[model samples]
Target: MKFGIIGTGTVGTAIAVRLVEAGYQCLGVETRSARSYARFRQYLNRDRMPLESWVPEADLIFITTQDGMIGSAAKNLADRKLYKDGQIWIHCSGSQKAQILKEDPALPVKTLSMHPIQTFADVGEALKLLPGSHFGLEGEAVEEGIQIVWDLGGIPHRLDPEGKPLYHAGSVMASNYIVALADMAVQLFNLAGIPKEAALESLIPLMQGTLRNLEKVGLPQALTGPIARGDSEVVRSHLECIPLELQQAYRALGRSTLELAQAKMKLNGKEYPRQDLQILNYLLDGGKEKNNHGNCRENIRSKRNYC
Candidate 1:
């Protein structure tokens, strides 16, 4: 199929290169900035004509522009009557639904969003990573457009249009938050006199092992360490060791761990030892003076059913 890429950013370039390599005809690319146009020229076939003259020739168009620029770009293309009937327009933004292209109501075009669940530091790296990635697709014309993802060696999963934000949030948690959490780990390692590079290297094995465990056992069952074991003393020590600025993050993760532990049957419904429970309650309660009058012992008593 002939494809046109509307933005020459990292993702757009990567997608263009992939399509070209896969023997799909890449008609041309369009970008508003002169600098971006220069960048696109580098990767594109020098003999090919400019995008303004090529868009009308494409059977499929990829609106791979920045999230904020997608609607305007689509409208501009529609204004020029660039797309023909039965043409397909796909965007790569996870947070955006296909409705963004509704600005061109007269066009008999199929619009869809296909967001790959992978990070692209650059075009070259993205090209190497695109294969086998899961793509979240949503639109009125999803089935027909999904062939593009499949051609790129990606798995396509349909998502509800209204659930796009939540789906995107989940991806952010998995990809972006993991990076933030890694930074936090590196900071903690610095306290132990390990240099940033060394700390990052040291954590690689642990990260790989944790990933393996998740793959093998999944979620709460894969959970380990103090929270899973209901070792309130270790939990308390962790709280004490964390810096004041990071205490809230620690507490929040700890509470989440507790919830997971309970769900996994690691912790009984009854609370543990009174002293341990007191420490946990104190840490979880944000230093509030809330009463801990419930059955702490009963929480631990429920653990017998877990095994």
Candidate 2:
């Protein structure tokens, strides 16, 4: 496909590199600065043309701008009457839907939203992480988008348009919140007299090993630690030691972890007695148990059984 990249940012540059390496023709790029334009020019080894000039020539165009600007860029293209029938317009937005590209339905162009599930710390990181990563896709041209993902050696997963918020929330939890979690870990390390500088170095192996476990056994089977063992005393002790600001987060995560632990027990054919799980739940939820024991019981029972 002859592709044109709009906005030569980290994502756009990484994608452009992949496209050219995969033997796709990058017609040109539209960038905000001379530096960005020059950078993409070297990567594409082609002229950096204006958006209106290139949009008409390419079979596929990537609006790889910020989530907020993607709609405006597409609308600008429509205003210039550049969209052509049968052309595909793609954006790597986790939050926005494909409809963002259809600023003018008169053009009959196809819009596709293909978001990488992995984080891109930079263009280099993006290139390294994008391959073998999963792409959350939502669009009319899903098959076309999937082919593009495959070309980049990424796995494509379809997403419902209505569930965009929830889907992106999963991404935020997985990618963005890891930093928050690392910060929390660093604070605890500091309490133990471990320097903040060394905290991540010490923790990285543990995190990597946990990730490997998840890949090897998948969820429920991969679960471990205090909640998995149905150890209420340990859980309570952790709640006591963790900082006050993190208490609610700890509890919320603990409640969900308990569910996973319950499933693990069932899957492994080692039943955790309901009373033991109940004790852990009571500790995690605190006053919620007092307020509505029946509702809490219903909530626990309503959770999926992995076995």
Candidate 3:
């Protein structure tokens, strides 16, 4: 299949290079800025051309622009009557739906939104991580367009257009939120006088082990540590040691961990000795607190066999 890439950012260049390497013809790339055009040329080893020139030459076009620019770019292309009938136009924006491309009725393209569920810090690393990642696809042409995902060694999952924002939010929680949590961990380690690099190096093994446990055992079954053990003293100590700036985050995560532990049958009906429960209550009672006792008991009974 012949491919034309618009925007020429990291995602666009990475997909373009992968397509070329897989023996698909990459017709050309288009970008609005000189710097982006230069970067695209350097990464794809192809010259930048006008959108009008490139859009009509390929059977498929990828509009891998920033989320805000995608609609405008699509309109611009449609105004020029750039798309040929039967051509497929796909965007890599996780939060956008295929309907964005249908803004102009003059464009007879088969529109689809195909978002790779992986971070692309740069084109080089993105190319290496492309294979085996998930791609969320939405549009009428989904089945036909999914072949390109498979050709690129990716798994394609169908998503409802209405749920695009929610799907993208979940991805952000999984990918971006993890990074923020890691930063919090690093900050705690720094407070303990460990160098940033040393802290990260020390935590790598624990993080890997946790991920392995998740992969092997999954969710509540993989949960461990103080919360899982219902060790109120350790939990109290954690709350006491957390700085003011991080206290809220610690409490939020603790509540989540407590719920997970309860779901896993790790927390018994009797609160951790009164002193421990007192400390937990002090930490978690302030904001929208819910009665966890009944829910905890129900979860324990339901998953008793797992314990």
Between which residue pairs do clashes occur in model 1? 268-299, 268-302, 268-303, 269-299, 270-298, 270-299, 270-300, 271-296, 271-299
- Give one digit per residue, the lDDT tens place, for model 3 in 1-307: 8988888788888888888888899888777878877877786777777777777878998888898999988888888888888998889889889889879655578998989999988888988999998999998689976898998889999999899889999999888998888889998777666878999988888988999999999988899898777676565555545566787888888888877876776333533455555556665644333332324323333533111
What are the TM-scores, per candidate, against the unseen true structure? 0.85, 0.89, 0.84
Model 2 segments beyond 4 Å from truth?
Answer: 287-307
Ranking by lDDT: 2, 3, 1
Tell me how far the alpha carbon of residue 243 in candidate 2 is from the true structure, in angstroms, after superposition.
1.9
Q: Each prediction's Cα RMSD?
A: 7.9, 8.0, 8.9
Taking the tens digit of each residue's C-alpha lDDT, what string does model 2 give over 171-244? 89987888898888887666556888899899989889999999999998888898999887677666555556
Candidate 2 matches the true fold with a TM-score of 0.89
Alpha-carbon deviation at 139 in model 1, angstroms: 1.0
- Could you tell me which 10 consecutive residues in candidate 1 have the lowest summed lDDT? 298-307
Give per-residue CA lDDT, model 1, range 23-51, as digits (tens).
Answer: 89987766777776676677766333565
Off by over 4 Å in 3: 266-282, 287-307
Q: After superposition, how far is residue 123 of candidate 2 from its true place, in Å?
A: 1.6
